[model samples]
Target: MLLQLDCLSTCLTSSGSVLFPITAGGGSLDCFSACQTMGYGQILHRHGNEEDRVHLNVGGVRHQVDPDMLLRFPHTRLGRLLLCQSEAAILELCDDYSPAEREYYFDRNPRVFLCVLNFYHTGCVHMMEELCVFSFSQEIEYWGIQELHLGPCCGNWYHERKDYIEDGDWDIRSDDQQHPSLDSSFEELSALDKDLAKFKGAWCGDLRSYIWLRLEDPGHSTASKIIAVASLSVVLTSIVAMCVHSMPEFQRVDDNEKPIEDPVLTVLEEICIACFSVEFIIRLIVAPSRRKFLGNPLNIIDVASILPFYATLALETADEEAAEENEDIENVGKVVQVLRLMRVLRILKLARHSIGLRALGATVRHSYHEVGLLLLFLSVGISIFSALIYSAEREVEHTDLGTIPSGWWWATITMTTVGFGDTCPVTPAGKIVATLCIICGLLVVALPITIIFNKFSKYYQRNKAMEGQFAESIDFMSSVIISTRTNRYQTDSQDVKDVFFSRSSCS
Candidate 1:
């Protein structure tokens, strides 16, 4: 700004010559007179870039620099100042400028300036080991050097710091403590917060809130913990029932040779579904935001896991009443089977009670991009190999693949390394293509898996850290949320309640 002001201050007279230039007379005459009083006027004419060396006293450290050499990068802070034609021009660049001693004093950090000085000669900016990435960046910014100028050796440290600040989960804790738009001292914070606050906590609903805490957060109370345990037990029973009745030992054949459903497992499933239905109803009634509760993915999972049973019942009743084609009945049965399979999603309900499951949930939520990249790589590899393999075996008489479309199934199974063997390469050429596909699959799959695993670890570690901080509160159950923190002693814990609210993603 000072340099810009100095440039803009220059004005033209009617003659249109360089009248009232900052280095010459007029407004600068005072600075020139002060120099004369200090004996600077005598040698002012000799003060040019051709001088042998310029003396500098930066933050108490003394140095001698060649004036011409400093002009190598003339756009920088010191470099721009060296362009000054007179002692008056150098006034803006330095403090305590003494022409008699021929030294310029600067209050800036002596350590970082050394790096700046090195850049003038070496044409590279090196970050100091003692300075943090942010501090080093600030110094360089002040010196008019781009952060991109940092050498490759230390670039990772700078880039890593930048990336972490922008994207990492490490800042959640501090962020929770510091309310957005309310960093003022206590009295002002209270005043501002009170004005902006909403009345949505447990106090507003009282008993409903109490019920919500129990059903939602096992850590809230003994009753809630018991409810969580019961919920978990019911979920396990439902899952087990779904699996067990399919076993040959549990099967019963009717007189017509139709398979009869196990009566005991049927009753067990009903009981579990009943428990889930009741729990969902209670949570829905008490949840601060019914829409948000319904919107929550875990809650959606709960509904998904429960609705299948009721739908199956409805379909079974319809089947008895309607005289439909056998194929149509089979299709309805398939639909019903799909609904039943949705019961498997009930295991995600366990995320409500276990931090590990919740962390896994969060990992999946955040790793979508990496997952998409993995899928994309797989798609390209699959398409290429499918075409290559089909072309290789197309002439073969007894090839498993009959068409390019058919190779899709082969390619999918092959790239996934599942190798169902139902569709495979018979020709040696196709086999070689299969080999390359498998290798590419491994590389493609491994890359995303590592990233997803890292995200899982981050969420898991973060959750564990929170659990450690609130060991007493989080011991029995998971409440809800990703990237949220809750202070248990707050006037109402629900002020920042999780949507599933373990608020492992809690605040």
Candidate 2:
């Protein structure tokens, strides 16, 4: 006679409780009844007075739970798997039991199940100190728990494990006993590393890889290049439009004058604004982190440049309305003109997509110290020349340099060789000082320019070399793949030939 060791009965009591029996040969049914009374194998029925109750047998341990509570975390696999209404495969076991009193068994870690159960109940998951992060992560995945749903403790553990994996702590191996050659292994490793980097970057929400490929990478796709080119054209057109708008001929006749609109310029301005606004908004939205996006100086410039266009429109409308209402109302056209000048800053956005501009920006950054020193020297020269001219021209009557402030302006213009002729020294001492200032200006301007140019050239060459190396790496990877495929084909052909000979000999 066969002995039944563990059997779950489909019987339901009058009180709506399931009975499960753990029996051996000729064992008393009293033991099973005793276990049920001790709450070892009881399944609470849905129609019972205990409406939200459920009884689970996990790792041979009885757990009383609330189905309503577990259903709160519908995203979790366990939550769905345990619920009667869930369509998960794990719930199919319920069909073996009576619908009035369902009893299900799961060979799972009771301790871990308790932790998961609590998480569903409390929205908090604590990582057990004894359990390794890797093991816990596996269990979480098995349970269909989302990483985002992890509490702070488990979340940190997950990130630590993620970082370890990304840092190449894991080993890569082939299933075949005959290992690949050194060159092939190296190529495989390189490809794996690249793929791993992309995966990690995406997981961390770092948009750098995506942005670089679309906007900055030298080997840009056709669509990306088209976008870049179109954006460049719009930016250039905007600059030209602003220039034309600033001309004297484009100014209104007076504060009250109704401005004549140029259809072409208006349409062009709108198009440029629309393009820039769309680009800015798209980048901002797709950025991995808003803080990181706003932190970039170039991104800040992009937003600033686009804002003035809308401001100008608003100001123009207000100015037109104010002009008609009151002659005393100040014309905001001048202020709008000043704000429109800021649109010129959009030209800097080219640096994001253009190699030459990027190199130039790098050059400037690298030469910051050198530029600072040059400015220091220029400041000293300006101060000395201003003092001398002020002292000399102060004694002279009817001179623009009669005051120290005026003298400073004269010094600036004279030293830069920008003689507007509006202010000039009238005395012998002042003339000598002005001559010295002009000579100093030439040296000061040329020194910084020469230093910047040298730095720019160096960085430009470095960038070119890096691009060349990148292209070579891509070609080498392609060649490796082709060779590997060829070798695989040859090995398969040899295996087929040997098999054919063996069959013929057997025949």
Best by lDDT: 1
* lDDT, each prediction: 0.69, 0.65
lDDT value, candidate 2, whole model: 0.65
- Model 2 worst lDDT window (10 residues): 169-178
Per-residue lDDT of candidate 2, residues 55-91 (tens digit)? 6777778776766566577656545555432223445
The digit string of per-residue lDDT tens for model 1 on 1-507 reads 453234323422222123334564354555334333332222222234434367889999998787666666777776776666556667776777875666789888899889988887888888777776667788788878887777788788778876775456443333454334222234333432332222234345446644654665566668876887888888888878888978999999899897778899888888888888888898887776677578777888888888888998999878866655443455877887788787788877887778899788767766667888988998898789888988999998977776878888888888888988887788899889999989988888888899789778888886776544443433322332111225444525555564445656565
Give the lDDT of residue 172 in candidate 2: 22
Reference-based TM-score of each model: 0.62, 0.46
